[model samples]
Target: MHTFAPKSIASHWRLIAGLLPWLLTGCASAGYQMPDLSLDSLLGSDQAAARGQPVADIGVTRCDQLTTHEDDWDRVNGVPPVDGEDIDIAAAIPACEKALAEHPGHRRLQAELARAYAEAFRYDEAFRLSGQAAEAGSLYALIQQGHAYRYGRGTPKDIDKAVNAYQSAAKAGHIGAMNYLGSTLYQRDGWGDRSKAESWYRKSANTGNATGMANFAQLLLIDGKQEEAFPWFERAARQGNAFALQQIGTYYAVGGEPAIKAPYTALSYFEKAVEKGRPSASVKAAKLFIQEAGDTSSRLSESERQAKVLYWIEYGMPKLSTRQ
Candidate 1:
C-alpha cells in the first residue's frame, strides 16, 4: 500500500560459497506457478522497507496540503482498513481510483493502486498498472508483474518473462525479488543455477529477509552445517516466518547433534506455528502428541491420549487439505 524508489540494476551476480540446505518452504524456481487465489496478504512495500533494503525514495503525499487528488492519495494510504485492519482490501480502492482518475501519470500512485487491485482480485487492472509502473522503473511493480505473468492471472503464463521480471527487480535490490530469483534458479528441474541462486539468497539474507534467511539456512543444513544453519532458522522464526516456525518444531522433534530431542518442546513449537497459520504444524503436533502418549515411559493417561488423537484427526487433517 506504500511506494518505494527503485534501485539501479546490476549486470552480474556475485557468489559467496560455504554451505546451503533444502528449502522447506516452497520457492519460485520449483516449477510451481502462482496460485489462482487472493494475493490479499501481500509483502507490501512498507513491510519490505521495514524488513530489508530501502527502495528508491518516492515522496509521500503531504496530508496537510489539499489538492483533491493528493487528498485522495493520503486517504488511500491513511484510512481505516488499509492503514491498520488489512482485512477489508476493497476499502482503499475508491480512493485510489479517484486519485488515478485525476493523476494517471503518477507512477508511484499507479503501482499502489495496482497492488490494491491485486488484493481485491482484480488481476487485469493490477497487471495493467503494474506494467506501467515497471516501465516507469518501479521495482515493486516489477515484482507484481512477475506474479501476474507466473500465474497467468491477467496475462499468459510465461515462466521466462516471470524470471526476467524477478531478476530485474532483484538487480534493483528488491528483497522479495531476490528471494524469488534465487528460488527459480535453484530448482534442479528448472534453470538450475546453484551458484547464482545461492548468491541471490545470500544478498537477500544479508539484508535481513526472513525467507532468505530460512532458505539460506536450509541450504547450509543440506551442506552439513547444522550448527551454522540453526541460528539463521532461529532468526527467521523470530521474524515470524511460518515455515521457520514449523521447521523449528521439526528440529526439536527430530533433534540433531548438539540439540537434545524433546518431543514436548517440539509439540509446543508446533502448536505456536499452527496459531500462526501453518497447517503443517498441526500434523507435527498431532504426530508428536500421539507418539508421546503412546510411549510407555510417558505419563499421559489413556483418556488424554484418545482425546488428543481425536482432536488432531478431526480438526487438523481437514485444515491441512484446505491449505494444500
Candidate 2:
C-alpha cells in the first residue's frame, strides 16, 4: 500500500467521464427503506450531490459487444430476468445455437448460448451448456456456471454447488468471483469472517481490481475503521473509482477535529466525488458548499448534470432484487 496527501479536493479538473461504466439508482425518498437487505443511506450522500442516485450495481457500457450482459441476462441470478417472449430474445437462441453446433468445443460460444437459453426460459438447456462450459474451466464459463447454480437458473437451488463454482472461478483468478467470495465470507457467524474477507479483498486489490478495494474499504469505513480504510479507498480512487474517491474526500472533509460534526472535510470529499460524477454526492456537496464557504465549483460544474445519473439509475433499475 502507498500513501498520498489528503490535500484540497479541488485539485481534480477534467470533466470527461472515466473509462468504466457507472451504475446508479436514486435512493428512496428519505424515509423509504430498501426491501429485504439493510441499506443505510441508499443513494449515498455523494450520489445526492447532483441527482443523488443510489446504485445497486455497476452499469456496463457497450464497450465489448457481449449481448449477454451481467445484469438480467440470467434471470435466475436474482436480477429478475428480462421479460423475454420478445423477438430479440427469440432470435438470440438460434444464433447462439448455430454458433455452438458449428463448434461444440468453443467454450465461450457455449457460455453465450447458455445465457440465451436462460433468457428464453429454457432452463434445462441453459444448465447443460453452463455446466459443460464450467467444467471446461473457461473464466467466463465458470462465472456463468456459478451464476446458474447460485441463482438456480436452469439448475436446482444448490448453495454449496454455487460456492464451489465461485471458488473455482476465484482459483482461476476471476475478479468478480474474488470480490463476491470475499463479501460472502464477510457476512457470517463463524464461517465468513472479516479477516478472511480482507485477505481475499487484498488479493483481488493487488491485481488492481477496483471493486474489491472499494467494497472492502466501504465495509471497513462503515465499521468506523477510517484510518485503516483510508489506504484502500485511495487505491481504488486512483483507479478512478468515484465511490472510493468520495469516501477519501469525505475522510478529509470531516476536519479530523474529533467530534465537531466534521462537515468541512466531508464537503471536499463530496466535491471530489461529485466532480468524478457521483450525482448524489455532487448535489449534497453543493448544499454543503453554500452553507460553508468552500469552492464548490472548482472541479465540479455549477450546472448539475442529472442525465448521467438518471441514465445510470434507469439502466440499473431492472436488476434490483426484492430478494436479499
Candidate 3:
C-alpha cells in the first residue's frame, strides 16, 4: 500500500523507542523472545501487499463469484468475496447447487456450495460437501470441516478433530487456517497454549493476513506490549479490517507515545470502523462528538454539535443492543 513519508517513518521509530522498555520487560517476564520492530520487518514485501489487493470479479463461475470466501488463499484474480455472514444465503445456495450440477465433482464448487449451505443452516449437506472437497485437495474446504466439528454442526462437537482440520490446512499454507487454528487454541482454556497461539498468529500475520495481524496485535496488547501491537493494528486497518480500525481509533483517542490524541482523527477512524461493521465504534464516535462540543477550543456551534451527537446515537443504538 500506502507509502510512509520519511518524516512519518522517523516519528514512528521515536514512538517505538519510547515504548521499548515496556515491550522488553513484558517479554522477559513472559519468557518470550522480543519481536523485530524494525520498519523493514513491519512493512514486509511488496508481494505481501499485492496479495491483499482486491479485484472486482473472478469471472470463474457464477458460484465462484457468489460464494468464494474473502480469506481464501487460492482466490483467483484477487477477487474479494463477501464475508460469511454477509453472503446472500438464499441466492448462493441455489447458484452454487446449479454450478455444481453443471460441473460435476468440481472440488472448489463443492467447497463453495458447502459454505453457502453452512450459512443456510443445512449443516448435513455442508459437512458432506466440505468433506468431499477436502478429500479432493481443497484447502478451503478443510476450514469448513474445522468449523463444522468445532461448532457441532451435523456432527458431535470435537475440538481435537477441529484442530486437526485447521492444522492440516495451516501446514499446507492456508493463511486463514493459521488464524483460525490460533483462535481455536487460544480459546480452549486449560488445554490452550498461549505461546503456540501467538506463534500461529505471528505466522499468519507474516503472510499478510488482515485477521492474523489484528489477532496478533490483540494478543500483544493483552500481554502489555501496546507499543509493539500498534503497528500491526495499523497494518490490519490499512487492509480494511473492522477490528483493527476500531483499535486504531481507540489508540488515537488516548494520547500515547505512538499515537497523538486527536479527537477528530479518532472520530474519523471510529466512523470508518462503524461503516466496516464494527457497531461498537459508533458509541466511541458519538462520545467524541459530545466531548468536542463541550471543548471551549472547538469552533463548532452548540446546535451543530448536538445534531451530530444525536445522529450517531440514533444510528448506533440498534446495533449496540445486538452486539455481544
* TM-score of every candidate relative to the true structure: 0.66, 0.58, 0.75
Model 1 ranges with Cα > 4 A deviation: 1-92, 119-121, 188-191, 222-225, 294-315, 318-324
The best candidate in terms of TM-score: 3
Off by over 4 Å in 2: 1-64, 68-92, 119-124, 188-192, 257-324
Q: Over the stretch 52-124, how does candidate 2's per-residue lDDT look in tens digits?
A: 1211232331211233444211212222222233326656677767656766645556666776667667778
Model 2, C-alpha of 177: deviation from truth (Å)? 1.8
Clashing pairs in 3: none
lDDT values of the candidates?
0.60, 0.54, 0.70
Per lDDT, the best of the predicted structures is 3
lDDT of 1 by residue, 1-324 (tens): 111111221221222222232222343433445332112123344433432232233344321112112112122333222221242344567766666676665656677777667767788998998777666555667777888877787799876677677766664455667787788767623445676677778877887667898899888878888877777876777776667777777777787554567677667667666766677678778878867654421676778777766765565665332110
lDDT (Cα, tens digit) per residue for candidate 3, span 33-143:
433422123223542232223322335887877788754544555455766767877788889899789877777788899888887788999999988776665667778
Off by over 4 Å in 3: 1-59, 73-80, 294-299, 318-324
lDDT of 3 at 268: 76
Ranking by lDDT: 3, 1, 2
